[model samples]
Target: MQNDLVSIITPSYNSEKFIAKTIESIINQTCENWEMIIVDDCSPDNSNEIIENYMQKEKRIKLIKLKKNSGPAIARNMAIEQAKGRFIAFLDADDIWLPEKLEKQLLFMKENDLSFTYSAYRLIDEEDNDLGVFIPPVLADYSSLLKTNFIGCLTAIYDTNKIGKMYMPNILKRQDYGLWLKILKQIKSTKGITEPLAIYRIRKNSVSSNKLKAAMYQWKIYREVEKLNIFQSMYYFMNYAYYGLKKY
Candidate 1:
């Protein structure tokens, strides 16, 4: 396993407002040996142009433009297939990571011999102002994660050398949650680092901002994706609702 090479998968669509900062965060990482695979899902805006500009200067940054507008799941899957690093990390196009994020998290994983790991993250508004709220990390297994998705997509990293490359479900929303569940099923537990390492930008009009739509997808995940029984679905749904409300 080439422990030094970290492959970052980012799915971008119409993220021109925040994509440059996201790329700069990766470029400024304390750990130098990393490849960032950004898959553009046919954005109407010039998000791809910004990525192309970065690709010209940084050889580590690669951009894949999809002929059609596939969703984030498929875009991320495309990058995963092209990843050659020993460790796979996820960073959304609109989120920003700390300079030491990769360095510290990689050290934590190697020290603990962990295959899957996630860290805490801070919330940011559209204007890039810190909301002064943070999501603390927690150790998660398949059973516990069935109740709530504690691992933030921007802060999660899994080692392909240990668990192999796992892909997200084809579903639109909650695919990262599905990937975590899949990895947890194979490994015993996912370790948590409590320090906030990334900024998750929350847009007012984003799909995640719509509570009704997000709830529907969560239900679909439990019922269709996981195939949990109605009673089990309700049991987890209650916990999800409680935690979802409490997160803010």
Candidate 2:
């Protein structure tokens, strides 16, 4: 088995409230052959300080502080430039991962010779508590991708040799979604595991928590950005609506 290094890139801004839990999850991962690069986007709060304290104790954790408040996409791209791993993974500042996340995802990627893969994720509350269970579709091809972005960003892992580093989109909200589309266009196939590997925190104040705004951005991606026609837009829009309705 080829054991390639996995680099976890996290972009943060004023995330002191959850950054520690996020870092601790990485510290406790069963797959230890991984390094975490945390890019702090000039957080006005103590986020950088908290990360610095952890970095003192853990060599695998590296922190990059920005000079100004750039969006998460810019922060992620900066971290990607510094990544040294053969496999690339992403973790939001507020999310947590199970210990076997990297181990299981890596095994699946290598065994299938898959260029990239993502898995289902569980939703968590603001207090690091589980909301319930949610599993994504076992995406086998691009057609499934068009139906919905069932592949959770936090659960995604990819072989850098085949797909290369994720190009962080300038668009703020749906940056991960955009990269997934771009990468899917390059790779022959992409898949997702049925198991939940990460915890997606749904904070009441998060950008994603706003249904209307989220839908607007989703519409922009499907209609304007991807430039899908009306019929194609409705097909994906309905898939989005189905998932949104299921949340309640």
Clash counts for the predictions, in order: 0, 0
lDDT (Cα, tens digit) per residue for candidate 1, span 33-122: 999999999899999899999999999999899999889999999999999999999999999999999999999998999999999898
Candidate 2 lDDT over residue span 125-224, tens digit each: 9876778767776665655676666777788877888777767678878888877877877774667788888899998977678989988888888876
**Per-candidate RMSD, Å:** 1.2, 1.9
* Model 2 regions lying over 4 Å from their true place: 1-3
Best by lDDT: 1
lDDT for each candidate structure: 0.91, 0.84
Determine which window of 10 residues in candidate 2 has minimal summed lDDT.
Answer: 139-148
Model 1 misplaced regions, further than 4 Å: 1-3
In candidate 2, position 77 carries an lDDT of: 88
